[model samples]
Target: MGLLLSGVLVWQASNAAFVGVTSNANNSWSAGTVNLTNDSGGTPMFHVTQMVPGQSGSRCIEITSASSVPVDVKFYTDVTALPVDDIRPYIDITVEDGTGGTFASCAGFTPSGGTEFTGTLQNLTTTRTTYANGLGPWALDGTPPDKLSFRISWQFHADAPPVAQAGSTPNVAFIWEAQS
Candidate 1:
């Protein structure tokens, strides 16, 4: 009789309790990226033949960032492989940043804000060596199309020394970098 009563109690308890179950599926994560490009189309910005002292010219190039995260953009010169008779000092460069331009033309380019840089190439190379001290760290949220045009105007100093008369300046490479 006792065994029968215990079995009945166990059955009643098992049937009286309630149960619940829940689960979350497909948990995952991904990382954002920063991508930078320019309008140059793999072409050199300037290619002048026989650039003499006192001669001047300018070119414009637009750079943009297509990044999913915020980023900082900067421009600088790279390892130009200067020869023994490098003529960087006699060349004056004026850098301006604004909007509307391309590597092929500066038609719609407009200058805004202060000049990014205005000095000799030697001074620029020394002062703006790397991204840490480069031309700009344009803090951008990488949205609404982050874009800026840089106009590099150069003038060979009229008073260039005789040593630089026929000497060719080292080939220079302008680089743009965007970092998050």
Candidate 2:
């Protein structure tokens, strides 16, 4: 009876979508609708590629928030040959608003009313040290690509319009670090 109960609990937990206070696929920003370009400053360097969701190569996601608080973002990858321990990867989430503005210029997207993730990307990016405990959610900072669940989100102003639309929406291009 004890063993059976334990197994059942483990199975149930795996099915639970909400983990680490961050949820998956909730308020998703449709791919291929985002606009890709160099930020106004142009000091920070990055690249973008167009890919259909669930198509060949890797699928990329861009999300915009309609809420006042910052939602923790996460990305889980398809099956891979390397173990989570041996790999190193990060995602550069260029969060934009409904009006097609970058996070930098958008004042309403500021993060609030959320606990700072202990291993959040902000800490890692500032420290500039690679190879932390194990592969978890980290902010994109142009590191070597690895098998990783790319997770990134930022707070958006409540009045911001929708950044992604269904079939005929304009999308943005961002470099998925997991790939070259």
Candidate 3:
């Protein structure tokens, strides 16, 4: 009986001699973002103090996606104040994709092949258009960032009665909004 008890005790002690090692692992996660910016430099896009009949002017704005997520870009205009002479009906406004160049020189722009708005500035103010839809998940690898160039052009029609429009529309606002 003594020998049997000693053997059982030895077996139990050997079973308790087993060993183990443990380690911890951890990680973190965060949300993505969508951002948009324009090249206006803190001023209204178009500013014409003196426009003449049969004369046209253009402005270029470059919009970029400084984001890690894809987004849709929309465009609209708000006429804070209308022209005193009500020349809105006589001015033709057109928006196109710029071929290249700055606001002072948009000679590289290409018209949308008649998709442009040929009506008055009043109509344009009330209408909202989709400039870029479903743009992109901009690369963090630094490829040429997802970007778009726009050319906004307007003309005082030659056929308009010159005597009817002597004042200027000084407060027109163009807005760009983005959604992820």
Candidate 4:
């Protein structure tokens, strides 16, 4: 009798089951991601500003953690321009840790995924000629190259923190004016 009942059930299809499967398939069709690749280059443009001091070496600027984007330096004339060039009156910074005001903090930055960042280095300043967007003066005693500038710019990502967190904000000095 059990075998007979099983065979009957298999032969009879339920309307509910059919509807569920159809709905799932239709939903999948509406959820496809559009993939496209377009590449171009131009002169990048940006202005610079100063960073406020924070407690114990951290500054007023903060970024979200766990982001995978890589922050790179690019020059531009407009924010919307791809590879913007001819940026005038730039500044470079020389960061000093709390250990005697002589350490360089090359603050790297990246986009915050979809999140909104309050103080983006790109949007902070806008004086094309008199703006602060140049590195001051720097001497490299470490692994990476050193720079100086006119304004204060910090590039941060989810992974690397700025170097001036353990000391004084003044430990990180701004050199100002970088010709790239």
Candidate 5:
């Protein structure tokens, strides 16, 4: 004899599990630098043997910044020594910014970047002596050859009280400062 009694039938299917993960490694930080150079090549912008009354001249210099970050460049002056006769008051200075020029001459300097300063040499040393009162905050994009040109024009006043400025030598050094 055989038993044949069944109640209910049940069926189940196996399930598969999935997993995923991701990660980032080798994280670091660094600080960039600000570097500036000029096309002057160790040459003085101007060296006048004799500057007579009503004499005038101009020079152009290109400034380049090799900064790794964006920066603003300021222009200032460093007066080497006062003239023997204090002739700075008689000398006029006109500073401009543009392109196509060199330390030797401002023949091709176009008035693109606008005038920076217009005053006497004495005022330049006294008033605009520091970066805070400097001529420019020229913006540079941090490119390797971010360049800006400056044209400095000077003149000796003609309508003067016949004051002789013979052997009166005043030296002024133009400077550029770059900051973030």
Candidate 6:
């Protein structure tokens, strides 16, 4: 009996020694973020003074992504104040995707095929449209070079009726938003 007990004990010890061991390794994950900014130096992206009939003006605005992930970009405008004399109808505004331009100049800028928007400033301000979509999968440090430049142009129509009053839109706000 003693001998059998000893053999049993030895077999149990050997089986225990041969057993495999395992431990859990923990891990965690988090989602990235999306951010967009207007690269224009400061306020008043488009500022024109003394606009007259048959006269045109343009301004360049640069946009960049500082996102950690991919994002879609969109544009919006708000007419904070309108001309008191209702001169909006006589003004023609156009937006174009531009390249190789600075905020102060659109020299060497290549227009993206056609105009993105063409209408009176008052009308454009009421609507929010997609200026550029599916922009990029920008990295945290804005990798892949996610950048865009746009040109906003306006002209006082020569054929405008004589009744068009002399007025101005003092404040117009342009906004850029991003989504992942």
Candidate 1: residue 68 lDDT (0-100): 84
TM-score of each: 0.83, 0.18, 0.67, 0.16, 0.81, 0.73
Over 1-180, each residue of candidate 4 has an lDDT whose tens digit, in order, gives: 999998878778553455433333444333322121111121111222332232112221221112122222222222333222221112121222211111132244332233112243333333221223422122222222232121223443323234423322111111122222
**Candidate 4 lDDT for residue 48:** 27
Q: Write the per-residue lDDT of candidate 5 for residues 1-180, one digit (tens) a residue.
A: 123222212111223355578999999999988999998998888787677778998888989899999999999988876766777787799999888787767678787856778998889888877888887788988877888888888998886446654646467788899998
Instruction: Give the CA lDDT, 0 to 100, for residue 24 in model 2.
Output: 64
Q: For candidate 2, lDDT tens digit of each residue in 72-119? A: 223222222433332111222222212222424433233323422333
| Candidate 4 lDDT score at position 128 | 28
Q: Put down candidate 3 lDDT per residue, 1-180, tens digits, no spaces.
A: 999999999999889777999887786789767677777777776667677788887788877767676666666665665556777767788766534655556667665344434567767865642344311212232222566667777888888885656766647777666666
Give the runs in model 6 whose Cα sits over 4 Å from its true position. Answer: 1-24, 129-144
Q: Candidate 1 — which residues are off by over 4 angstroms?
A: 1-23
Question: Candidate 5: deviation at residue 114, Å?
Answer: 2.7
In terms of lDDT, model 4 sits at 0.26
Q: Cα RMSDs of all predictions?
A: 3.5, 24.6, 6.1, 19.8, 8.2, 5.1
Question: How do these models rank on lDDT, best leading?
Answer: 1, 5, 6, 3, 2, 4
lDDT of 6 by residue, 119-175 (tens): 887677766534443222222343535777788888888887766745666477777
* Backbone clashes in model 1, listed as residue pairs: none
What lDDT does model 1 reach? Answer: 0.85
Point out where model 2 deviates above 4 Å. 1-41, 45-104, 115-128, 131-180
For TM-score, the strongest prediction is 1
Candidate 1 per-residue lDDT over residues 118-171, each given as its tens digit: 999888876887888888877879684788898999999998988986666667
Q: Identify the candidate with maximal lDDT.
A: 1
> Residue 44 CA error for candidate 6 (Å)?
1.1
**TM-score attained by model 3:** 0.67
**Ranked by TM-score, top first:** 1, 5, 6, 3, 2, 4
